[model samples]
Target: MPLRLPPLPALRFFEAAGRHQSFKLAAAELNVTPSAISHGIVGLEEALGVELFVREPRGISLTATGADYLSYVSEAFSLIAIGTQRLPNHRADRPIALSCAPTFASRWLLPRLAGFRARWPTVNVSVDTSHRQVGFPVDGFDFAIRMSRAPVAGTAWTRLFGERFVPVCSPAYLATLRDERGALSLQRATLIHVNAASEDWQAWLDATGADAIETSGGLRVDTIQLAFEAASMGLGVALGRKPLVDSDLASGALVEACAQTVAAGTAYWLVSAEQADSAIRRPELADFKRWLVDEAARFDADVAVADAVADTVPDGHVETNR
Candidate 1:
């Protein structure tokens, strides 16, 4: 038996009208006259033997049956679009869209993008900074890098790296904290805070058993990059996440304020499009996933080396800059 369906044009008109809740608006969207939309809907209702919309003096509204039908129609459109987008003619030059946390994009991912471009010259990458978790496919994002302790449902999650929070400050500022006892104490020093990473400071204090020091008073920066910059300028001490601070720490811009770090247990996760089939069908997306995992692994290896080196330092021995 042949597939029983309303006319394609009628279905389109009804779907548009139901979405906008106005025949006039649907006509404008479909580039047709309001009378045409009305005729299409009439034909659709006759075909289905059901009244889809309640015509009103001001505008049209979906009937109970129409509202239910609209959901299936909209979802069908989305699936059709997804299938079309995965066709071979979709082309490779299309940019891979990724949404990530601002600090991760700035301090970690942006620097390494040149390497990504070097490896995948034909593939372009677009980055959108956001803290909000994205819904893939519907949100039109190929991937999202979210900071969380666990994987998100309905997406492929690849663990990046767990957070290591450490107290960092400028050498000049550290000098100001030193008393006649030749010991540095944060009790008298101002703390720098990031509104988003506020828990870092408390975690550090809790882990180090330095609860006596007041962590409440400080300049609050909105992003991790800004907090790190503020700390490097001798403004105050900031609890820095290792991934964002590793380069600055290695270059002497920011020094460890104490020989203590708190394992935050939270990690960066690369979330692919909701469907595994999407990645398998789109080579560019697969390439992006592979590249991101490789970069994260390289970062973890580097951090491991740094941790080993720091371990070699004798206990309670803090390096002082002359």
Candidate 2:
């Protein structure tokens, strides 16, 4: 049988040494220590049962086998790199990479992304969603959106929107309550609670002064998006993040049964960097920002309208259910 090559990692080391002709140079090129390069090449040579290089005081030189192998190795690595660079664009001709919080990605941002895709038919977007606070340069994120209470310390942070949280459920659930004061009946509904936050129904009850409910029963989820999902499915009433669950509310998947909103102590922001903010030069980011600001203004107007409705309505008619 012909000789089977060693594994990829070992082959790569031998290939580096064959071209550069010095294990030291190969080590430097690969960002590995010299001993690592030596060990890797030794493994490769043992596997191949052939000596491919010669070391001399002057320097290292390639044997006939080494010279021949270098050509194939170089070509292989070049093709591999080209293949890697093209992976993100596999679905399209062009690509734009974006990063954001996973929950925001699943809920609000994703819903709006179709419009961007429709408008820019050629630009494919790859989303990287995570909750770990990722820095721009260190993390290699192109553009990102983040939700937070405090301003980010070292970046060009653009205020996207501030949102309040409210108790929401299917309107059918609300209609069943006998006493309006018991509406925050954490005891009755599945109080779909978000996990990342420190509090649950117990904390919510304490904060809102809703003393009647048990505040102990409910399924807990890791993200606001999941809470909204449960609420939409009628699994429970969720303390909904307004930005995330607004679509659900509008679609009647869920309804805002209470007018009381507990400030979530956080807001969402569009973020990039001072340098990478140049991505905004593409005009897509700017357009999105404009539309988003308009939407937030509309939401604020709705809040004002709700306040007006509450103020004008008589105390008896103001149904205290929410």
Candidate 3:
């Protein structure tokens, strides 16, 4: 017997609209007009002989029956996605395209990607270092890592880690800033700044109660990576963001100018497009996500251990010059 069902397109429209509870957002996700979403959903409701949504002047709300039906529709789509992915022709070598910030790609992900390659030798990962926030699936990106205080809209995300800022500079630069008491002073120190993080220095100063320090003049750079390089070269002190600067600190290329660390009130998140099938078709994507989460956890644990050790040491007034 033939399966009885509503129009597939109409069902899709209903699912999107119900998921977002806004025709406008659903339209954006599907790359259709809001009017089209409204009309399609209306057709779906008519075919089902039930009112799926309560239309309001400001927005839409799913009815009880609509919510119940949506779960089944969503489940069916998931099953279809799983089956499609399991098809014999689906190549294991298909690449996972990722979008992220240039600084993150260079300073963090690239260095650790070798571990991912070892785990999934057949899977290829492509990195696109674009500042622009690309829409998932539509933009042809498998995942994106973004820095934000909160998760980006219309995407599922995992919080990787929070950011903290500290003053960092070359050993020679730090030595030059030291007074007769062997204490570091920022009064005459050059404050290197990043254009994107203009307020970082000021924020750090506020946190450390170093309001007396002059922040008016400094060498400005386009990215945090450049700022780090300048600091390492003894040009000036830069407010280095953690994780990005972790390698530099570990390598002794840069040292903290002060013991104080200020939270940036932001964090890096791993994001993927909000879709029913997200990563279901790509087992590699799942593996990549697991690996990323584990790596983040390990970093956090290492930081925790270091902080514990530092707590046992006597606090000193002397700060690193280099």
Leading candidate by TM-score: 1
Tell me the tens digit of each residue's lDDT in model 3 across 15-70. Answer: 77777788887888788999999999888878889999998888889899989998
lDDT of 2: 0.66
Off by over 4 Å in 3: 1-92, 276-278, 318-322
In the predicted model 2, the residue pairs found to clash are 258-322
* Alpha carbon lDDT at 65, candidate 2: 86
Model 1 spans with C-alpha error above 4 angstroms: 1-81, 87-92, 317-322
The 0-to-1 C-alpha lDDT of every candidate, in the order given, reads 0.81, 0.66, 0.81
Q: State the weakest 10-residue window (summed lDDT) of model 2.
A: 313-322
Model 3: lowest-lDDT 10 consecutive positions:
130-139
For candidate 3, the TM-score is 0.69
Model 1 TM-score on a 0 to 1 scale:
0.72
TM-scores across all candidates? 0.72, 0.56, 0.69
Please give the RMSD of candidate 2 to the true structure: 14.2
Tens digit per residue, CA lDDT, model 2, 1-322? 9966568988778767776677887787678998999888778878888887787888878889888887777666655644553464533333455678887777776777776668666666678874444444323444677777777665677676676667788877765543555434334566777777636455446566767665456778887777777777777778877667777878988887555566566677777645444333345555555655665566667766765785575533213324
